[model samples]
Target: MSILLILALVVAMGAVLYALVRGVIAMANGKDVSGEVQQGYMQKRVLYQGIAIVIVVLLLVVAKSNGS
Candidate 1:
Protein backbone atom coordinates (compact mmCIF):
# COMPACT_ATOMS: atom_id res chain seq x y z
CA MET A 1 0.00 0.00 0.00
CA SER A 2 2.68 2.43 1.00
CA ILE A 3 4.78 1.68 -2.07
CA LEU A 4 1.82 2.12 -4.34
CA LEU A 5 0.94 5.34 -2.66
CA ILE A 6 4.47 6.62 -3.11
CA LEU A 7 4.48 5.76 -6.81
CA ALA A 8 1.12 7.40 -7.31
CA LEU A 9 2.21 10.53 -5.50
CA VAL A 10 5.39 10.74 -7.55
CA VAL A 11 3.52 10.29 -10.81
CA ALA A 12 0.91 12.82 -9.81
CA MET A 13 3.45 15.41 -8.79
CA GLY A 14 5.54 14.88 -11.91
CA ALA A 15 2.54 15.26 -14.19
CA VAL A 16 1.36 18.39 -12.44
CA LEU A 17 4.81 19.92 -12.57
CA TYR A 18 5.15 19.15 -16.25
CA ALA A 19 1.78 20.72 -16.98
CA LEU A 20 2.52 23.78 -14.87
CA VAL A 21 5.75 24.41 -16.72
CA ARG A 22 4.13 23.98 -20.08
CA GLY A 23 1.16 26.12 -19.15
CA VAL A 24 3.34 28.90 -17.84
CA ILE A 25 5.37 28.87 -21.01
CA ALA A 26 2.25 29.06 -23.11
CA MET A 27 0.90 31.96 -21.10
CA ALA A 28 4.26 33.72 -21.17
CA ASN A 29 4.33 33.48 -24.94
CA GLY A 30 1.08 35.49 -25.05
CA LYS A 31 -0.95 32.94 -26.90
CA ASP A 32 -4.64 33.58 -27.24
CA VAL A 33 -6.25 31.09 -24.90
CA SER A 34 -9.63 30.95 -23.24
CA GLY A 35 -10.32 30.24 -19.57
CA GLU A 36 -11.77 26.90 -20.46
CA VAL A 37 -8.80 26.01 -22.58
CA GLN A 38 -6.31 26.69 -19.79
CA GLN A 39 -8.41 24.98 -17.18
CA GLY A 40 -8.97 21.97 -19.40
CA TYR A 41 -5.28 21.50 -19.99
CA MET A 42 -4.43 21.78 -16.32
CA GLN A 43 -7.17 19.42 -15.23
CA LYS A 44 -6.48 16.83 -17.91
CA ARG A 45 -2.71 16.91 -17.85
CA VAL A 46 -1.64 17.99 -14.37
CA LEU A 47 -4.50 16.94 -12.16
CA TYR A 48 -5.16 13.64 -13.88
CA GLN A 49 -1.51 12.74 -14.29
CA GLY A 50 -0.66 13.52 -10.73
CA ILE A 51 -3.54 11.48 -9.37
CA ALA A 52 -2.68 8.52 -11.60
CA ILE A 53 1.00 8.55 -10.76
CA VAL A 54 0.41 8.80 -7.05
CA ILE A 55 -1.97 5.87 -7.08
CA VAL A 56 0.43 3.68 -9.06
CA VAL A 57 3.43 4.55 -6.92
CA LEU A 58 1.57 3.90 -3.72
CA LEU A 59 0.42 0.51 -4.93
CA LEU A 60 3.88 -0.55 -5.97
CA VAL A 61 5.47 0.52 -2.73
CA VAL A 62 2.86 -1.24 -0.65
CA ALA A 63 3.16 -4.41 -2.65
CA LYS A 64 6.95 -4.52 -2.38
CA SER A 65 6.91 -3.80 1.29
CA ASN A 66 4.38 -6.50 1.93
CA GLY A 67 6.14 -9.03 -0.24
CA SER A 68 9.49 -8.36 1.37
Candidate 2:
Protein backbone atom coordinates (compact mmCIF):
# COMPACT_ATOMS: atom_id res chain seq x y z
CA MET A 1 0.00 0.00 0.00
CA SER A 2 2.74 2.44 0.97
CA ILE A 3 4.81 1.25 -1.96
CA LEU A 4 1.95 2.01 -4.30
CA LEU A 5 1.67 5.50 -2.92
CA ILE A 6 5.38 6.08 -3.41
CA LEU A 7 5.24 4.80 -6.97
CA ALA A 8 2.23 6.92 -7.82
CA LEU A 9 3.95 10.00 -6.45
CA VAL A 10 7.04 9.30 -8.49
CA VAL A 11 5.03 8.88 -11.70
CA ALA A 12 3.01 12.01 -11.03
CA MET A 13 6.13 14.07 -10.43
CA GLY A 14 7.77 12.67 -13.55
CA ALA A 15 4.72 13.60 -15.61
CA VAL A 16 4.75 17.08 -14.11
CA LEU A 17 8.39 17.50 -15.06
CA TYR A 18 7.74 16.30 -18.58
CA ALA A 19 4.91 18.76 -19.08
CA LEU A 20 6.97 21.64 -17.70
CA VAL A 21 9.89 20.84 -19.96
CA ARG A 22 7.63 20.67 -22.99
CA GLY A 23 6.17 24.06 -22.18
CA VAL A 24 9.61 25.57 -21.72
CA ILE A 25 10.76 24.14 -25.00
CA ALA A 26 7.79 25.54 -26.84
CA MET A 27 8.38 28.97 -25.35
CA ALA A 28 12.05 28.85 -26.18
CA ASN A 29 11.19 28.20 -29.80
CA GLY A 30 9.81 31.76 -29.95
CA LYS A 31 6.29 30.51 -30.45
CA ASP A 32 3.64 32.98 -29.41
CA VAL A 33 1.94 32.04 -26.16
CA SER A 34 -1.05 34.29 -26.71
CA GLY A 35 -2.84 31.67 -28.73
CA GLU A 36 -5.74 29.83 -27.17
CA VAL A 37 -4.12 26.43 -27.73
CA GLN A 38 -1.04 27.40 -25.78
CA GLN A 39 -3.16 28.94 -23.05
CA GLY A 40 -5.19 25.75 -22.76
CA TYR A 41 -2.09 23.63 -22.50
CA MET A 42 -0.72 25.90 -19.80
CA GLN A 43 -3.98 25.68 -17.91
CA LYS A 44 -3.98 21.91 -18.09
CA ARG A 45 -0.40 21.77 -16.90
CA VAL A 46 -1.23 23.98 -13.93
CA LEU A 47 -4.17 21.75 -13.05
CA TYR A 48 -1.97 18.66 -13.20
CA GLN A 49 0.63 20.24 -10.97
CA GLY A 50 -2.02 21.30 -8.49
CA ILE A 51 -3.45 17.79 -8.37
CA ALA A 52 0.01 16.32 -7.92
CA ILE A 53 0.72 18.66 -5.03
CA VAL A 54 -2.54 17.77 -3.34
CA ILE A 55 -1.85 14.07 -3.70
CA VAL A 56 1.65 14.43 -2.33
CA VAL A 57 0.44 16.42 0.67
CA LEU A 58 -2.26 13.92 1.41
CA LEU A 59 0.14 11.01 1.13
CA LEU A 60 2.60 12.65 3.50
CA VAL A 61 -0.13 13.46 6.00
CA VAL A 62 -1.40 9.91 5.95
CA ALA A 63 2.07 8.48 6.34
CA LYS A 64 2.81 10.76 9.27
CA SER A 65 -0.48 9.90 10.89
CA ASN A 66 0.27 6.22 10.62
CA GLY A 67 3.83 6.62 11.85
CA SER A 68 2.77 8.40 15.00
Candidate 3:
Protein backbone atom coordinates (compact mmCIF):
# COMPACT_ATOMS: atom_id res chain seq x y z
CA MET A 1 0.00 0.00 0.00
CA SER A 2 2.83 2.34 0.87
CA ILE A 3 4.57 1.52 -2.37
CA LEU A 4 1.43 2.20 -4.33
CA LEU A 5 1.02 5.52 -2.58
CA ILE A 6 4.61 6.39 -3.33
CA LEU A 7 4.15 5.58 -7.00
CA ALA A 8 1.03 7.72 -7.16
CA LEU A 9 2.87 10.56 -5.47
CA VAL A 10 5.60 10.39 -8.10
CA VAL A 11 3.09 10.43 -10.95
CA ALA A 12 1.29 13.39 -9.44
CA MET A 13 4.55 15.26 -9.04
CA GLY A 14 5.45 14.50 -12.64
CA ALA A 15 2.13 15.89 -13.80
CA VAL A 16 2.79 19.07 -11.88
CA LEU A 17 6.15 19.38 -13.55
CA TYR A 18 4.62 18.78 -16.96
CA ALA A 19 1.98 21.41 -16.45
CA LEU A 20 4.53 23.92 -15.23
CA VAL A 21 6.73 23.38 -18.25
CA ARG A 22 3.82 23.65 -20.66
CA GLY A 23 2.61 26.82 -19.02
CA VAL A 24 6.04 28.35 -19.24
CA ILE A 25 6.34 27.40 -22.85
CA ALA A 26 2.95 28.82 -23.65
CA MET A 27 3.79 32.10 -21.98
CA ALA A 28 7.09 32.30 -23.79
CA ASN A 29 5.43 31.70 -27.13
CA GLY A 30 2.99 34.53 -26.49
CA LYS A 31 0.41 32.69 -28.56
CA ASP A 32 -2.38 33.14 -26.03
CA VAL A 33 -2.55 36.90 -25.66
CA SER A 34 -5.69 36.64 -23.54
CA GLY A 35 -3.84 34.40 -21.03
CA GLU A 36 -6.78 32.03 -20.63
CA VAL A 37 -4.86 29.01 -21.88
CA GLN A 38 -1.92 29.69 -19.61
CA GLN A 39 -4.31 30.04 -16.71
CA GLY A 40 -5.70 26.57 -17.40
CA TYR A 41 -2.22 25.06 -17.28
CA MET A 42 -1.56 26.87 -14.01
CA GLN A 43 -4.76 25.46 -12.58
CA LYS A 44 -3.75 21.97 -13.60
CA ARG A 45 -0.36 22.40 -11.96
CA VAL A 46 -2.02 23.51 -8.75
CA LEU A 47 -4.41 20.57 -8.81
CA TYR A 48 -1.60 18.08 -9.33
CA GLN A 49 0.41 19.66 -6.54
CA GLY A 50 -2.56 19.30 -4.23
CA ILE A 51 -2.88 15.66 -5.16
CA ALA A 52 0.80 15.08 -4.45
CA ILE A 53 0.47 16.71 -1.07
CA VAL A 54 -2.51 14.57 -0.20
CA ILE A 55 -0.63 11.44 -1.21
CA VAL A 56 2.28 12.41 0.98
CA VAL A 57 -0.05 12.90 3.92
CA LEU A 58 -1.63 9.54 3.31
CA LEU A 59 1.77 7.86 3.10
CA LEU A 60 2.79 9.40 6.38
CA VAL A 61 -0.39 8.26 8.05
CA VAL A 62 0.05 4.76 6.74
CA ALA A 63 3.63 4.62 7.88
CA LYS A 64 2.73 5.83 11.34
CA SER A 65 -0.05 3.31 11.64
CA ASN A 66 2.33 0.55 10.62
CA GLY A 67 4.81 1.66 13.31
CA SER A 68 7.44 2.44 10.72
TM-score top scorer: 3
Candidate ranking under lDDT, highest first, comes to 3, 2, 1
Instruction: Give Cα-based local distance difference scores for all models.
Output: 0.68, 0.75, 0.96
- lDDT of model 3, residue 3: 93
Candidate that beats the other on lDDT, 1 or 3, i.e. the better one: 3
Tell me the spans in candidate 1 whose CA falls farther than 4 Å from its real position: 33-37, 45-68
Could you give candidate 2's per-residue lDDT for residues 1-68 as a string of tens digits? 66777787787777777777777766667667576555665676787788788778888888999999
The model with the greatest lDDT is 3
Worst 10 residues of 1 by lDDT: 32-41
Q: Give me candidate 3's TM-score against the actual structure.
A: 0.97
Tens digit of per-residue lDDT, candidate 3, span 1-68: 99999999999999999999999999999989999989999999999999999999999999999995
User: Over the full model, what C-alpha lDDT does candidate 3 score relative to the true structure?
Assistant: 0.96
Model 1 scores a TM of 0.54
Candidate 3 pairs with clashing backbones: none
lDDT of each residue in 9-57, candidate 1, tens digit only: 7767777777877766666766645655566656667566757765776
lDDT of 2: 0.75
